[model samples]
Structure formats: structure tokens, C-alpha cells
Target: MVTTNKEKDLYKKLSIQVSLNGLSFCILNRKDNKICYFKKVDFEKQLDPIKVLSKIELLYEQEEQLNQPVDEVALLFNNALFSLVPENLFDEDNAASYLKFNTRILKTDFIAFDKIGQDTVNVYIPYANITNYFFDRYGEFEYRHSLSVLIESFLSLPKETDTPKVYLHVHKNYYELVIIENGKLVFANSFEYDTKEDFLYYLLFTAEQSKLDPEKFELILLGKINKNSEEYKMAWEYIKNISFMGPFHPFTFEETAKPKEELSEYLLIKSL
Candidate 1:
């Protein structure tokens, strides 16, 4: 990211994705539904989102024009409890127990689903006070767990061709491994890995547990990985049909003028 002392253009709508170790912001023109600017700031071994948010608030305060008349800011968390309970059998009050977490710590459990065509009710925990602070004047904003949105993404698109397909969304030092068979989620788990071996172990282990053959199955990788990266190379060595999923926006993803450094964050914003 370029260091700029200049004030930013006040976007009408914005999307922000915050994980344990990073933050990304995309400002948009509401009328055209086009991106104006994107900025990503990654933290090192820090987990407090509140500290990261304070820095964002400082920018808003310093640039008054960028703060006023902002219509909506959608905040999605990378870390959250993901649940896919059958609609009829789901209990709103007992959502925490399903994830084996205390209700007190994760106070706000929001139930969300695709309005048009969805079978299950996916519940996620979003921060209450920090989220509230974002829209103190307006009193409300859109929210989604990172994983929950991905489930909706699969639902809204063309069905997978393979019987057991894996989508590995790699983050800083961790990744979300999911097994989808014909648009049905069979397994969803996140694993923390510090090396290529660690990543491969969790991936193959998940596939083995899910009864998916490595050779027969398709593994589509998303987030932070590239052809030259060790993780990608190691994956290609072991997995047969491994492929990288990149930015599906303004320009179709092809090796272009510059390295698509922020494409992963762009994908998340596109998911919004």
C-alpha cells in the first residue's frame, strides 16, 4: 500500500473484512457500484481487533469528509462460529452449545441465510460494542461471518462438477478447509499452520476423514497463495487437480501489469 498524506474520497458505501491478523477496506461508489480505492493492513501476531479498529477510527476522524454521509459499512469477521443446523430443528438460544463455546463471551449470535434459496440457518457471532461504534449515528450495519458468506457464495453459483471438492482458503498462518459434495457442506474446519508441511497435513487429513480420494477430488485454493509460493508448489506436488481462484472482477484474472497482491481481499469485497 502507498503511504498517502492526502485525504481519501468519501465513499458512499464501504466493505471491511477483519481477521485475527489483518484488515482490508474497500470504498465504493454507490451509484455505479464500482470500487474507488482498496487498502489492506496486516498485523503481526496480534489478535485484538479493537486496537486495529482504533487506527481506522483515527482515519475517519482525521478526514472528516470521508466520514460524513457514509451510507453503509458492512463488517465481516474471519474468526467466527459457523453452524448449519436444519431449519426446523434449529434453536436460536442453543446456537452456542453447537459450537461448544460460552454464550456470555460471544454475546451476539446472528442468524443469516440466503433469502431466495437456502435450506439451513447459519448462525455466527459478531462483536457487539465495536460493531455498534461503527454506526453510532445510524444504529445498524450489515454483518456476516467469513465462512458463512462462503457457504452462500457456493449456493449462489454453478454447482461443483466433482463429487467431493475442497476449497482451501488460506489466510496469514491458517486456512479454512471445507469439503463440498454437490453444493452440500460435508466438513468445515479451520487449521493453523506455520509451514507448507503443516498446511498439507491439515488438508490431506481433512480429506481422509471426509472419505475423499486425493487423486479423484478437486481442490480449488483461494486467498493468499500463488503459483510460485511454497504452499502452492507443495499442494501441486501432492494434489492432482489443485488450482488457484483469483479476482473475478474489473479485469478477468490473468498475469497482467502488476502482481495481483490484493486480489484475495478484492474477492471478499466482491462477496459482499
Candidate 2:
């Protein structure tokens, strides 16, 4: 099949996000302001370093064979030492190393302790935040960051108008509920809890701190969590302000290149 230059370009560039347990990758046509394809992969069980890269390479080759032209890649991951394998390991002679082909990794779950400049915080992310700790900190942090990026990207879409849009992200690990008023993050915060009572307390505490009336603003939940979980039910029993985000899935991207199922999915969410 004779693929056009435009079509080939569509397959070469990818926006990828690699999480502690999964990968999410997407193809974007920046010139056209369009997303050509996307996919998600889960990699929680495999621990071998070589197996991981082999899987990633398989995905790339699959895409290429399908006539996908991907020359650029964007990767996202947690800020942890264990996940930091040397960039050279994934290389094959003169070929591309997964890290080298895409070195732009945005370390999520990081908080700046010292102010570096205007609006820039010198942040520090707990290693535990992105690792297999006593608690599910890494998963929680990954989900939180993924949800944030997803919401931000949606809001920043080219055609979005200049208006306020409220959002809520519910992860198994955390909840990110916020409002973006006129392209500005008017209010936002993350809460943690295991019990219903604790969750309610955090939400109420956050509402008060943001100074936004729950009755007036819109609320959304992002991840795979029950809005009707007993805790969620009890909290909203009297409060009629909050709303569930979607019975909808994120916009899916179709592509020619395929990665190891796990890495592909992880990168897909990151890039989203």
C-alpha cells in the first residue's frame, strides 16, 4: 500500500506516558491538531528489565509494520530510583534506546519545596510516592498525575472556549476535584482516606479551604472508583452539589504501531 507523506508522519510521532504499573501512548497530529491513535498497557507483574524493553520494542515494531511513522516520542513516568534503568540498556547497537528516542520525561508526584522563580516551586517527590511501598503510594500517585494530565489536556484542546469548567478525578488511591474558571485553575486539591468518614472529612475540609461553594460549582470523578461506594453515598446523601464525571471512556486513539500491552497502555495514559 502506498502511504502518503502525511499518513506516514501520523505514525512516527507519539505522546507516551509510562507509569509504575502501566503505560499509555498516543499518536498526535500536531500540525492538524488531531490525535491519530492511542492505547494502554498494564505491566504490574513483570519485574525483569530485559523483558520490559523487549516488550516495548515489540510494540514499536508492530506500529511501524502497520505503516506507522513515528520519529518522536514523549515519555512520562514516576520519580523513583528503581524505575530509573540506564538509558543504554534498551539500545541495540546504532538503534534507538527507548529512553533516548524519548528523553522528555515529566516526573509527576513532585512538589517544589523552594520557590525557584515566578510560579515555579522547587519540588521534591517522595520515592515512596512512586515505588512499591507499604501502602499503594506509587499507584495512587500515578493515577493522580494521569488524571491531572488527562483533565488538563482536555481543557487545553484547541477549540475549547474561554469559559470555566469544573472537574473531579476519582482514583482508587486518591481524589482530585477542582474547578478551572476561565482557563485558570481557580481551585484544586488532593485528598486521601480509607474510610467513608475520613473521605467526607477531607472533601469538606477541601471545600472550605478553597472558599468555593459546593452548591455552585460542578464536580467530576476521573478514575475507576465507585461514586456510590458507601463512603461516597454517605458523603453525598445530604449534599446535592457533586456529580459523577462519566459513564464514558476517554477518547481512544487508533494507531498502526503496537507496544507491549503493558507499556503501551501506561504510555497512552501519560500522553493523554
Best by lDDT: 1
lDDT per residue for candidate 2 within 1-272, as digits (tens), equals 12123234444445555434454566665665456665656675533434555555567667543235544544443322111122233223322222333233344423222221123221223323323331221112222234344445545534354444455455444455555665555554455567778767777676667665666654454454455467658766645555554323244344553333322143254453
User: What would you estimate as the lDDT of candidate 1?
Assistant: 0.65
lDDT per residue for candidate 1 within 1-272, as digits (tens), equals 11122334443566677776877766666556566556566776766657767766776676544454555667777774455566676776666655555223344444343221355666555655456666664446676677776665655556747567788877888887777787776777678898899989999888888888888898988778778889999888888888766445552222221225654663456643
Per-residue lDDT, model 2, residue 165, is 49
Candidate 1: list runs displaced more than 4 Å. Answer: 1-11, 62-68, 101-117, 250-259
Best by TM-score: 1
Q: How many backbone clashes does candidate 2 have?
A: 38
Could you tell me the lDDT of residue 65 within candidate 2? 34
Q: What's the distance in Å from true for residue 136, model 2? A: 30
| Clashing pairs for predicted structure model 1, backbone only | none
